[model samples]
Structure formats: C-alpha cells, structure tokens
Target: MAQLFTPLTLRGITLKNRIVISPMCQYSAEDGFTNDWHLVHLGSRAVGGAALILLEATAVSAEGRITPDDLGIWKDEHVPGLRRITDFLKAHGAVAGIQLAHAGRKASHSSPWKGGAVVPASEGGWTTVSPSAVPFTENEPAPHELTLAEIQQIIEDFRVATRLSLEAGFQVIELHGAHGYLLHEFFSPLSNRRTDQYGGSFENRVRLLLEVTEVTRAEWPTELPLIVRISATDWTEGGWTPAESVQLAKLLKDRGVDLIDCSTGGNVPAAQIPVGPGYQVQFAEQVKREASIPTGAVGLITDARQAEDIIASGQADVVLLARESLRDPYFPLHAAFELGVDVAWPPQYERAKPRRR
Candidate 1:
C-alpha cells in the first residue's frame, strides 16, 4: 500500500488514511446555520473515501464571522443543523471535524466574490475587535483593541464552542490559529501590537493561543483529537518565523494538541511568498523534526505520487488537500486507483469503482 493510503491514529481516532480534506471556507450559510449545501458539499467528500473531512472555518460568534454568510456555532440552536452534516459524514466512513475561527481585525468583510472589501456598520457589519486597534490594512478602519475582559470573553467563547462541537457530533476540532484569523492575529507580532500581557515577548505573544488551547482541551473530550492549523511563517522579515512555529508546536503538544497543520503566509498582504507545489512542505518537515510532533503538510499538494512521497519520506504524518479537493471531491478514490491500493468504495458507488489492470 502507498504510505498515503495507510491508517493514521491520533488519540482515539484512527483515520483510515493520511488524506485529510482541509477546511475551506464555503461562505454559504444563513445566520450561522448549516443547510443542504453543506451536507452535500462535505458529504460528497466523505463518500469519495477521504478518511477525515474537516468542515470550513466556523465562526464562534456573530461578530467573528468574516462575512454574513460564514457558518457559525455560537449558539445551541446551531447544533442540530451541524449534527445533520456530521451524521452524514460518519455514515460515509469519514471522521467529521470543524475548524473554530474568529476573523478579528479581518472581520466585517464582504465575501471574496463580493470584492472582499470591508463592510461598514451601516451595511449590517458590526465593529471588529483585535488584540490591538490595528486594521489589517491601512485602507481599512482600525478595529477596537480588546480589553482584558474582552480577551477573557474570547477565551470563554472558544470554551463554549468546543462544547457545542461535541454536541454537534464532531470527532475532531481544528482551531483556526492560522490564515491571519483572530487567533493568528494574537500570535503574529505584525498583527498583535498589544502592550499588555498578551504581547511584546515571544511568551506574551503566544499567551492567548496557549490559553485558548488549554481551555479548549479542557472542554473537548480526552479521547478525541485536537488540531491547530498555523501559518508557520509570515514570509517576511522580522515576522513570525519557522523557529517560533516549532516552539509553538512543542507547547501545543504539551497541552494535548494532536497535530499541527502547517500552512504559511496569510498575516501580511504585501509579504512575498514563493508559491509552488510543496512549497510549504518544508515547514511541516521542520516542525515535525524539531518539535517531535505529528504535522500535516498542506499547500498545493495535488497528486497521488507527490502525496505518497511526502508521507513515504517521513516529511509529514498526513497530507491535507484544499483546492485540489474542491476540484475533485473523490481525489482520495482516484488516488487509491492511481496508487494501485484497493481501498473500499462505498456500496452505492461500487459499480463505478475502477478495476486495476
């Protein structure tokens, strides 16, 4: 069997293979409710035979949503809709997961198709908050600097979101500590310019994420897996670096984090990033080797052989697919055929399963 086809066990969850459907924002929800669109979008991947299906970045609160359409889990009423999706995923043999996120200074933006501009209070957008009163870009209005009390509230929000995920029947929770989101805002110095306990030194900059992890782990079931997706580098000078990612990975492992999903370059819009196939894989390799933790390699990983080599060479424990998965929901099934691995096809699709020559 190809190494990519082999099972990977994290905590009590044993994924049938190393292919994970990376969380990709759909921006297609109504007041934070999941509907048939989510069911079919995520369920198709599960039926296609990916071992783990992580839902998109789900907002933990209304104000945290990047757009009015982003899915949310802030209230108890959202559980049933989410549970419906999880039920479908598990039935199709995929472990259901969700990424809890907050947009912070990046909040109140129109969806990508809508020009990706900032939406103002007059336009149904609320005031955005962040670790500091900084805007993501100079053209955008400055967000309100979070007070100490507000910081505590954000922590509680994560705690509550964790419980809500459990109720929604998800087996994994990946905190959105990457992509210049709220948690990422707190950790990256370029975004975090606070003068208090949550900023300045390395220890201080990472405090919010650490605290959020501690609380989330406390609320999450002991047997389930918890993942943190982080941009391993800011791709700019004097910004968050690979060394800090390794350091952060070590700290997360100590707090019961199961994996570090290594991604890069979302904190700064002007930061130059060398994008290409497996470009960010080096960060995953570095974190796994230095921090001695399981890491998932993401970013432009598109084919079976490429993914196989990543796991075969021991560079990363798993491979996460975002755009490729979007392009091919059955990438896992196609990959199995390409690699000559006899992974089972769903009975409904058995007639369509390709035969090895």
Candidate 2:
C-alpha cells in the first residue's frame, strides 16, 4: 500500500491521506477580504481530493501583509468569506487549515505579477515592522523596530486571529514562521539583532515565536491541530540552522504544536541554496526524529513515488506541495491512481475517474 494514501492523525484531526495542499498566496484580496477568486482557487483543490487544504499565509493584522493583495484574517469580518471556503472544503472531504502570518519588514510589497517590489505609500504600501530596524535587502527601506508593547499587541492579534479561525471553521492552524517573515525575523540572527528579551541568545530570539504560540494555543481549541511552519535553515553561515530547528521543534511540540512543516531558506538574500527535488526533506526528517514529533516535508516534492517514499520510509508524516499543487490541484487524485489507491472522486467527476489498466 502507498503510505502516502494512509491516514495520519494530528491531535484530534485525522488527515484522510498524507498529501497536504501547502498554502499558496493568491494575492487577490482587497482590505483583507476573500472573494470568489479565493473560492474557486481553494474550492477546486478540495474538489480534486486533497486530504488537507491549507489557506495561504493569512496576515494576523492588516499591516502584517507581505503584499496589499495577500489574504488577511485580521478582522472579525474576514470570517464569513473564510467560512464559505472552509464549508466548501469540508463538504468535499478535505480538511481546511489556515496559516496565520506577519510579514514584518517584508511587508508593503506589490504582488508577484506586479514585479513583487516594494511599493511606496502613495501606491498603497505602508511602513513595515520588524524585531530590528533592518531591511530585508540593503536597497529596501528599513522597517520600524517593534517596541516591547508593540510585540505584546501582536501576540494579542494572533490570539484574536485564532478565535476568528475557529469561527471560520478551520480545523488546523499553521503559524507562518518561515519565508523570512515576521516570526522568522525574530529567530534568524541574520535579521534580528535585539539585545532585549526578544533577541540575541537563541532562547531569546525564539522567545517571540514561543510566546505567540503559547497565546494562540490557549485561544485555539484543544480538539484541533496547531502546526508551525519554520524555515529550518537560512542556508547561510551563522544563520538559523537545522540543529536549531530540531531544538525549536522540540520546544514547540511541548507547547502543543502538533507538527512542523519543514522548509528552508528565505531569511538571507545573499545565502546560496541548493534547491532541487526533495531538497529540504532532510530538515523535516531531522525534526521528526530528533524532536520526536510529526512533521510535514515540503519543497520540490512533486511526484507520487517521491511522496510515498517519504512517508513509507518514515521520513515525514506528511508531504506538502505548493507549486505542484498549483500546476495540478488534482495531484492527490492522480497520485492515488499512480499508487494504486482507491480514493473517491467528487460525484460530479466520478464518470471521469481513471480505470485500472
């Protein structure tokens, strides 16, 4: 049997299979409101038979967005639109998850299609915030260093976002601590240089993420899964490393994080990454074994056999696909066939199901 097709339980939620639709930003929202575009984009995946459909890095606050068009769960009003998407996903037998995020200094950029460059306030951009007053790139404007009070407010924002996620019916909540975003900014020495309680030493650097998780877990229901996605490495010297990832994963597991979605790089622009097929699987494997927690392996995992190997060999509990899921929202359904697993198709598409050779 294909291990990828087997059920994997995290907390009280049992994923129907090991395939997860990693969050891919649509960059289609306005004022943090989801719309028909989101419905079709996410709904189609659920209809295609993915075991879990995770929403993109949804901002915990409006100003935390990486781009003005990124999705937001910052307000109570954002719940209804999200509820619609979650309903559609659940009705189709896919678990609905959301990634709560803050972009930090990486905020206030234009959408990818619009060059993905930093936008001026005149063009709808706003000043970004970070643990330190550092720019992601030297050419980019330096962001405001967050004061201690501001950090407390952000933690409260995450707690409120968790409440809204519950109201919107998300079964899983993944904290976005990867991709050189807000939380990553706090942990990566390349970005965070504070000498206060929130930075400097390893424990201090990870303090913000841990505090955020603790507050979020308190607000999030005990019955659901709470996952954190981390960039296991900055891929640069003296930056966040795989060893630190394992240590952090251990701490997170103790604080009720059910799984670690392992991916790498993004903290430093000058770092060289050896990207390839299953490039970051080792990070997930290390976290899973060393931390003794379930993990979701991500990054360049695009084939059925490769995904199956990861699960069957006990490398990771789940496989998350981002770009491949875009190219084929129905990847899971097709993978079921490739691996000889008999998963159901949506009734409307049953007539087109692949038959045995």
- TM-score, one value per model: 0.99, 0.99
Prediction-by-prediction clash tally: 0, 0
Q: Ten residues in a row with the worst lDDT in model 2?
A: 1-10
How many residue pairs in model 1 have overlapping backbones? 0
lDDT for each residue of candidate 1 in 289-354, tens digit (9 for 90 to 100): 999999999999999999999999999999999999999999999999999999889898899999
Weakest ten-residue segment in model 1 by summed lDDT: 348-357
**Tens digit of per-residue lDDT, candidate 2, span 290-325:** 999999999999999999999999999999999999
